[model samples]
Target chain A: MNPIANRYTELVGIDHPIVQEGLGPFRTPKLAAAVSNAGGLGTVSMPGMPTDLDAGARTFREHIEECAALTDRPFAVNIPVGVDNNGVVLPFTDIYIRTVLDARRVDQSLAAQLTVLTTSAGFPGDYIGMIKDAGLIHQHKVGSTRHAVKAAEAGVDVIIAAGFEMGGHAPSKAVHSYVLLPNVTEAVDVPVLLTGGVRDARGLASALAMGADGVAMGTRFIASSANSDWHPTYIQAILDAKEGDDVAFDGVYGPCRGLKNAASLKLLNHQEDGTGEVIDAVELTRWKIESMQRAQTTGDVTDGLVLTGQVAAAIDDIIDIAHFVPNMAAGAAEILRGLASALPDTEHAFS
Target chain B: MNPIANRYTELVGIDHPIVQEGLGPFRTPKLAAAVSNAGGLGTVSMPGMPTDLDAGARTFREHIEECAALTDRPFAVNIPVGVDNNGVVLPFTDIYIRTVLDARRVDQSLAAQLTVLTTSAGFPGDYIGMIKDAGLIHQHKVGSTRHAVKAAEAGVDVIIAAGFEMGGHAPSKAVHSYVLLPNVTEAVDVPVLLTGGVRDARGLASALAMGADGVAMGTRFIASSANSDWHPTYIQAILDAKEGDDVAFDGVYGPCRGLKNAASLKLLNHQEDGTGEVIDAVELTRWKIESMQRAQTTGDVTDGLVLTGQVAAAIDDIIDIAHFVPNMAAGAAEILRGLASALPDTEHAFS
Candidate 1:
């Protein structure tokens, strides 16, 4: 095993350094539990209910309870705080955070097992004190080194360097993982979890070599059996993709990378023609809710956009969690070992 | 737009199909003359002894003399094939080819007008037949499908698919343009030229888009005052590359890709690991000669390995070509004419 392996293992208390991203609506109790049980961190996204903070809190609590029942291993919850549709406040920021904290206070079992809380899409500096006070590790997703530095200063436990290749709403500024990972890792003292365009063992090896502690995969896990209900066509499209198939489109807030299908083409055209103006928070919420409902319930890939990472290019096949998680770990370990063995001998060898 | 524009238009008869492959020692004055004077072809290879029976008759004839004296149209000669030790074979190939054909028997002035003869590796391919043959055009060198196929099959008249990514021995297999362009365009029936990795607009746009009639390039071309050698680091690396960067070992005979580096990994490695041996001829050559040599010559990019055409990865920055070779000629013409305004009757159209 490589030295980074031991360090990552110690940091995450897992056999491998693979972390599954929190895919909202797609993230279910079973999926989270399966990833956690597979010896990697799994995260569940807090449920949102438009403007009704109380209702959203209730949904989140129930979801948390379900995830707790599914796995005995540690997992996390992702809270996204940012501007919403209609320019009106969504209230998910404070409501969701307080709900998680309140739930931790009331449920001893949940508090004991929930190992991490991931904050994404917006700054988490304000909530770091609350999260640490509750004794949970904090992970933040950052698109640039500046964001990473900010996260580090805010006491983020792990920094996820999300590059432009990532699916869903990625930062508009374009910085690839190759350039971003090294820069961010060098700047921050915290352990870095590299995201975006990482799909296989080779990618893992490369990232570790570049100074990342672990990899967080979104698209790869989404294609697994745990996500069987995901539209088969979308899944197949991802599987068939070669490296450069995807194109990023301007989303409501930023850029989102997905399959270049008719809907996406329409969105791109809209951006180009300057006709698709930004909808406010309420309108955005309704639009997303409707789109997700159409997509998830009806299996309309065109209606519901799938969030994926650039690593989708390498995912030619999908397997069960039981097989995938272990294979990923083993493959990385083997490559790392080979790389280490090839290195020139040092004075500390065997001593 | 660019200075090369007038030269390109004059050299290639048809608006967009004319190109030259940067061949090496194999490049001959007759070959360049045959292509350029034909009004459709241009070629460039190494400026050494013409190898082969036909070249002997054409000996003492310089690339410039043969090409310029043959035709007034634009033509070019590539000289970088002599940079490495393997280039020794270039003179031999040139001598043999020149000897077999009585090139001296032909009109020397007519031969001097040959347009282009791309050169790379040991020597250019023996092209005395096409040069001396009736109505034959010649162009050579390629990097990928975008580089070779159009030239090969379009009958535009010579094609060279070179795959040295940055410089050095071409990869034995996983990353050379030889394997990529050929495999993708094997159906082509025209003359195919091969060169190492080229460095220019004419090279980039032509090869990546598969529209070149032939290729003529030199890393040193950019270092010219007439050239734009983007970076000093890139220029020095190309000049310093060795035979290894240009040679392949264990080649299966066809083509391969990759750069020379410590890993020495090839596409063959993925074919079948059970036997612990390579099973394909093409793959073997790619690793041994092409990829290995490329690594040695390119420096740190030895790991960078300069093999392109698994394109879809944004590996190269796009440079402007003096000429525009539309991928779809008819469609481009229609768009250029603003035919949308001339469409009759229906304001609405259905696919």
Candidate 2:
């Protein structure tokens, strides 16, 4: 078998460069353990989020400890840097970041195992040195090449070039993965993990061929059995989708790609009337919490949004994580081998 | 506001539905006149065909005297159907289709108001019935929905359901058009003109939303000054397509979707295992002559098998046809106006 030869596999020490994103509330200990056990990086979102910095840190410790008990493989935590809409600085944001870092520092077992820390949303450039100094590899997610260059220049260990096609909160720049991946790969010296619209082995092989060292999947993993804690309808909504099914909506700081449904439709109509921007955090938070609870508790797909990538086109069937991840790696390896075998023989090595 | 109430529309008194297939050599003046001026229906392929179908039909005193002196509107004749297959069949299929149809047809005049015939491969479907049936219409082309079913559904006046995502000889069975145009518009009432990957306003408004009264096009038409042909490179390779950019060698009976390069790759590696049924005369002729010539004449797009449906994704800029066709019917009468607005409402009606 042709092995996956990439800087990501070497640096992350995973068999394949598939990294699971930390989807908050949905990123349970079970899902994280399954991803890590499956030979890809599994990440846990900070537990009991929006709590005070100390409470959030304590929850993070308990969760990391739970994951450590389940799988010995490396896992990461995603810390979204809180945005300051007004000029007034929020001390809570700094406390949260510092508290998460301190929590990781104090736990010897967690520190030894948490090989990567991915900071997304707001700028992570200021904290990259501190993250690296904490003895964890620093990874930053950027939506554009400008941001990618900024992250790389800041000495981030890896840059996640999240394309417009990806799920969760995508940047508003709107460059497609086909254009973004190759451009960032050419521009950056560090290993690039291609995120967005990557769902299968063929996608993996295609990404590698396009020069990405690895891929990061959010929607695909969320639909897996390990993620069954959510409503089956939520999972089914994702499974039923094809490439163009999802459209992005403007979230708090940026655009988020999700299944377009009643709620989103309302949001769209509101935007059309210029009423969407006025929704404050309290209203947004209540809507999100209610939507998630209804979706999770009652299996109602229409109640909330399920984040997804354009790669939904390729995902017709959903399989378990145990079978899905390794099979993806193997299938990609096989295709690469076939590609190599098909290459034409050439002369002029001396030249 | 108008709405497209019906999926199919009838002209004159044709028994079958209305569809305008690409007619290459088979695009005859007799054919166009027989289908249209007779009232049943008709279309002439685009001009510049090698044969003198345009001139030949004009020569017939009765043919010229009767129809050429009457009618006004657009008709169609197909551009050459390019295939990336090396000249495996002798005598060039496209030339034969072009020559035969061109020799038989006449240039459209005001009175006759010629509608063009378009064939993706070889000659267009037979036009004897259309000629015999006065005022009857005949347009036949298909990319999906079982070519035979699409072609033979006796109720259809025109049957062209080319997937908006297809490029060239898009066989219908492989990938469904949104799972096969709502299952072939619920298995045909009449008038189904569809083509692979038609781009633009009327394309979306009419075909997908309205269920198509008639639809016919060649890729180059969009690139025309009358259209938006764009850069030759953009037109040729279709802007840096991915590996799955096209589907070829699908083991189906008709042409497949894809760019010339991917098609060429498949052709070079075609299996000689002989486990499958031998290709028939029509299939062989289409592959060897008709498709090959078009590819050669058209250049690398044909070479790369650059037939595309997904190219719809990249076609953001609007062309003139984008403005014209809509206005034509949009301003027509209450009946036409109703048809114009029907599409979006129908699409939204589902939700």
Candidate 3:
């Protein structure tokens, strides 16, 4: 008897609906494995794109294998489908999707553990059928109701509704979770997981109340004890963040939410007045990716790009995934029950 | 046995926790009265600032009187406290506050009906004492947890935690409800009402689940049939709104959310590059007010400022306040109970 068992948990064969979502351009195999072993779904994030597509794919494969080796329970892999101006999928996205499929095809045990493939940043148009054919649950992350509907209609197994307050790459339309969740949930019949501004039991309960099946968190999981792959300084910055410490700046994607540090401020200033030193579009994109990796690898939180959600301001303590995941589900259940019982029996008066 | 009875309903003396929040610069006496009659809190919005300070106060007084006359139930008045560059309370804010206090002093009946006063825009500083001394429930709307703590410490009876997606004047710090509500509720002992991006039962349930005592809606109520004070075209504009149709612009206060029409585009264009023809600061402020007023009075949805929340995308039909208010509360309670029952009894396993 799981405190929170729903379509999401059943579909992925996990004990709880809690998910450690994609924290790409950073190493997250250990964090992913910890969450999965704790009975929640963990996701192996894509590594930073390199000049050689095969090199990027190999790194992504290694992370997935590391997570699979650590956790016997089901987990996921997140590949952001980067597209060019012409809507053609980028080489990195193409290679990474293949890497996951290739790894699973070779090893039966690895295939059983890696049961979900989540795509974001752009539509997983052609790759949707390919992923579905691989017998993996295909979850596409979208920021708008229209996109949610489009992805659902296109046979995507799940929809992770991304809000403007989410860290790293955010939706271009800027709809916040309060509005976006209900809209997306109402528009599609697929299981909806809210991704943005979610931290604890209250967030999960709120997501469930708004018709979301689960919550996929990035910033919260990043601050957890299991996430030792990232630099401790990055976690400290998240813990020390106060209100208005984060800002949305131009990224490889349309808009990205991150700490308002020297790197992000420089990007913001350049976006506003076009005053920063001239860099080509390709060079700038590569530089942004490298900056994000630097923060995670070298603990350079000041000059390096620190991607985080607005909810980071409220997160103060590091959590242990083993206790936190199941406890979160139990807490949400208690809260929902308490709220229900608290409401007076006004059906006679109203009805 | 009210469907949604809580600290908010108990503190405010309303049957349901639902609230028809402020729709300022527009008339809403009839809409407010209808909500009050339906056992929810109704708020009489502040009229636009006029060249004649006394006349503006008079208009506000008349609106309050009209709402009181329509409903014997307790109602509220929303006045945004405007401050000058030196932080001195503006003449209009001073006049409006006195106008409500004076109205009650002169007429006991009006005092009995108008039991609440909600202040937004700036901190209620000196006016908090005045509002509490008047025996009115003082609910100060804030966007950050710091402000909520400050207002609660200052003795505000209630705190309406406003999110970034709210219509009209938004908070200077762009904290969305997903991140803002739980933070504000945790920071203060006073009852917190979630305002912004809320509509219908799911929104109410989500608000309550996130530790909010209730929900305060502006855009949802604006599209109601009771809101006849606003032009039908204005209502139609809200009905026609879709995802990505609303934008936040430089407002009279910090920022304002509204439909992306000619007037808003003009303001946004000017804000970006300062390319719009130079106008005196005072004159520009006056124009923005007049434009907002024009949309309400005349059917000028095209050129006038059509203030609305991001939730307008999901609001396609006009609701009747008589049924919508109480039904919304009941629906939320039912949903909460249903969700509580649906969860598996995994308490033993988790514990």
TM-scores, all models, native as reference: 0.53, 0.55, 0.98
- Clashing residue pairs in candidate 3 are A1-B346
Better of 1 and 3 by DockQ: 3
Per-prediction tally of clashes = 133, 105, 1
Top of the candidates by TM-score: 3
- iRMS (Å) per candidate: 24.5, 22.3, 0.8
Give the chain B TM-score for each candidate.
0.31, 0.31, 0.97
lDDT per residue as tens, model 3, A1-351:
468999999999999899999999889999999999999999999998889988888889989988888989999999999999999999889999999999999999999999999999999998999999999999999999999999999999999999999999999999999899999999999899999999999999999999999999999999999988889999999999998899999998889999999999999988977678999999999999999999989999999999999999999999999999999998999999888767677334335
Stretches of candidate 1 exceeding 4 Å from the true structure: A1-4, A84-90, A228-234, A240-244, A276-285, A342-351, B1-351
Per-residue lDDT for A234 in model 2? Answer: 77
Chain B of model 3: TM-score? 0.97
Clash number for candidate 2: 105
True contacts kept of each: 0.00, 0.00, 0.92
Worst 10 residues of 3 chain B by lDDT: B342-351
Task: Estimate the overall C-alpha local distance difference test score of candidate 2.
Answer: 0.54
TM-scores of the first chain across all predictions?
0.89, 0.90, 0.98
